[model samples]
Target: MPPALNIVPFVSVDHMMRLVLAVGIERFLTELAGFIEEDFRRWSAFDKTPRIASHSPDGVIELMPTSDGTTYGFKYVNGHPKNVRAGRQTVAAFGVLADVGNGYPMLLTEMTILTALRTAATSALAGKYLAPPGARTMALIGNGAQAEFQALAFRALVGVDRLRLYDIDPAATEKCVRNLAGLGFDLRRCASVAAAVEGAEIVTTVTADRQNATILTDNLVGAGLHINGVGGDCPGKTELHPDVLLRCAIFVEYAPQSRIEGEIQQLPPDHPVTELWEVITGRAPGRRDAGQTTLFDSVGFAVEDFSALRYVREKLRTHPFYADLDLLADPDEPRDLFGMLLRAGAGPGRD
Candidate 1:
């Protein structure tokens, strides 16, 4: 007789916390950046799709699904900008990893923190190629839950040592400054977005507002600066002025999706923008001159989530405390999937 089948791993939030604590956030960001860069280098090997979005009156829910040839993954994330006022996280997320061959779920874990980490990692990865060498200072607009992660990622990857923070809500800026007080960064709470962007090498906009507000206007951007636009990821949600995009050499993760959701949405459909992979692969140029402006209009692609899922799966092997769940029913025979359901008496109209 064959041995009993094994149960799949269910990584709870606590299990993920252990993994993150053991690895440390900076190291995880470094590794995640490398994974994302590798995937972008082999961009054609994976199945990609624009995230499926469900818009409600107050917020939006998105499902990002992707797969390499062997592994598959998906993340369910909701963005409710107003939730923070009610003491809830503005973004909450969870994800699953599976084997493409058998379609069996291998792992499941919360992605709220993971999403913050990966978004920062992806931004820093683009900055590595797009920002000027020896870039040190960054202006952070919309200091909220993601501000700390973005600051840390830039500090670790792009050598950002000073951060100028700004938000319409002073409490949000205060919270961000408090979180980074002991993190070895020189933090300055600016009076306005212009003050924050002044003299900064990289400007990162991660606002939570779901409207079309301009955080950075054309007159505010300086030459040779790299812009990480993270807030305007949905239609009617924009952070940069239209002229700012017009003046800069724009780059994005995926073209088709970015054209609709990224800051480039304000530009014409025929407006020329380079894909980040092209710069990574040496197919296109980044920052042509010291005086040229560059923008990375980030919409948080599925491939980045894919990379994050893969990283967590690898980390789970080192820490065994993650719960094991049976999300998929497995039988001794691979072709007897329906048979197992029949044996369990879970057919139509039977509960």
Candidate 2:
């Protein structure tokens, strides 16, 4: 029998956790990165746009959408740095993948977890091409919820197991350290951002401040370092100093979006920057020399979310850790929309 057209596979938070555990974190990150890379290599084939955002005083809500001509995907995400104070996540999300031909949703899943994983995976993937050759040490400046995931991904993708960790809140750093214990990481709890960046090959600033904060200053960064600026993703929320941006060779997912939300937002509109797709496709260079400072000013693009949704869809084929949700109205006849509703009302118990 054919599957019901109304059935959409749904991976709830529990199912998402089970799926991640079933696939193992490192393996999941590596495979997800592969999907993201494949999509990036065929960059021109997809429809791309900057995320549509609705900003508020508290935070922002965004819809990130993309399609590769065959399938369409989008993620509904929110960022409220103040939410942590209320015992809620600073970032939360969910996403859907739909068949473009019929406009039917194929999969629905919790992206709060997937977003963290994909974000870290994308950062590590960028690190793979942009970070110095054989680099093993990283300065992770933000020890929030995304910190451990970032550490795991860097190790999985780039073989970086030595981490210098720092956070404005000492407890946050302690949480990150405790979570990563016995994970084969050489972890050091640093006193300040400067201490964290000292002697590190790659520096990752994933802070959660919603203001334009100088997480990484020019004086702290040195030659040949790769900076993964992940936190400064919204306008008025940036991590690196403008002078630091000027000092480095920069790359981004999409120029228009990055200009509005990434660390490059501080730079002029005409500032020379390379797209990561160009580097992955060999159309542009990644790291020119060992001494050149490189930065991947990632603002989290729609295509990455598209790739992640597709990855989850593929895994469901074998893993099957999702529940089938009857999300669509399926009528006995294609045009009997009213009849379908009428029948639903007249089910086992008559009115």
Candidate 3:
């Protein structure tokens, strides 16, 4: 194999957006979910941990790291809901993939867009396993940067084509509606969360807030609904009322981690919850019956980020959105690192 320090493949924000458009966002999501499922099937092979976070009054910065023996990956992400008032995205992220054998960085990519894509794909994938079969509609409570991605992912993966949306800021809802208007979804702008969830088989709460906000209460949630709670990710931040969790069959990406960052934080430590991987692997049941209510408490995980990075690495082989980044110093004598820089300065134009 070639030396690992020679070059790194870097996928920037513009490149990521171009790649998403080139591959078509829906298709990309569908493919990315396939990758996520494949990794989940062999979940035992990975070295995992709950993301390490530093919380503050403004937002939270997190580091998610994991390894599968041969390869390793981690993401740096931050969430600040107040950023929107200053015309900034509420979340920004980037990730790295490295060869575990050599401990050398291999890929670095902008993950803000990729994170949105994987999150939606994972939600839709969980829906496929948790939602009622032939479910055709979903209520998206937070219509922000992630709303459209969730809408398209559901439409592509769960066969959902109708969306009911509600956001405190009408402009956010308007942006979501405008973005997805002609995407074939039967869009409904609801006056309230209850209105959005009415007659909908699946409800996705993706609001961005930094508190224990009850975006969904027991009264709003009816039987047979699959709820995708996406935003209650940091400590002291949650969406559903405790009663809603008590009523639904909860599913999570990773138990130890989800219990800390997901909706289950409200429940007792030993509260019954199912792992989504078991459902994917057929080791556990997903939806028991047509009238069953299921909740996928997703706070995002490192394994999903690893899988996403792997997918992008494979794509870089054919697609050209990646750049060769000189991330590490390459020395002719391997140990003569100082000599290499000296040789460069010793060239014709040297001082």
**TM-score list, all predictions:** 0.93, 0.98, 0.97
Any runs in candidate 3 off by more than 4 Å, and if so which?
Answer: 1-4, 348-351
Error of 1 at 37 (Å): 0.8
**After superposing candidate 1, which stretches have Cα over 4 Å from the reference?**
1-6, 331-351
Best by TM-score: 2
Q: By lDDT, highest first, what's the ranking?
A: 2, 3, 1
Scored by lDDT, model 1 comes in at 0.89
lDDT of 3 by residue, 215-270 (tens): 99889989889999998886788999999999999999999998888999999999
Better of 1 and 3 by TM-score: 3
Q: Each candidate: what lDDT?
A: 0.89, 0.94, 0.92
Question: Which stretches of candidate 2 lie above 4 Å from their native place?
Answer: none
How many clashes would you count in candidate 3?
0
Error of 3 at 173 (Å): 0.8
| Predicted candidate 2 versus true structure: per-residue lDDT over 126-245, tens digit per residue | 999999999999999999989999999999999998999999999999999999999899999999999999999999999988889999989999999999999989888899999999
Candidate 1 TM-score versus the reference: 0.93
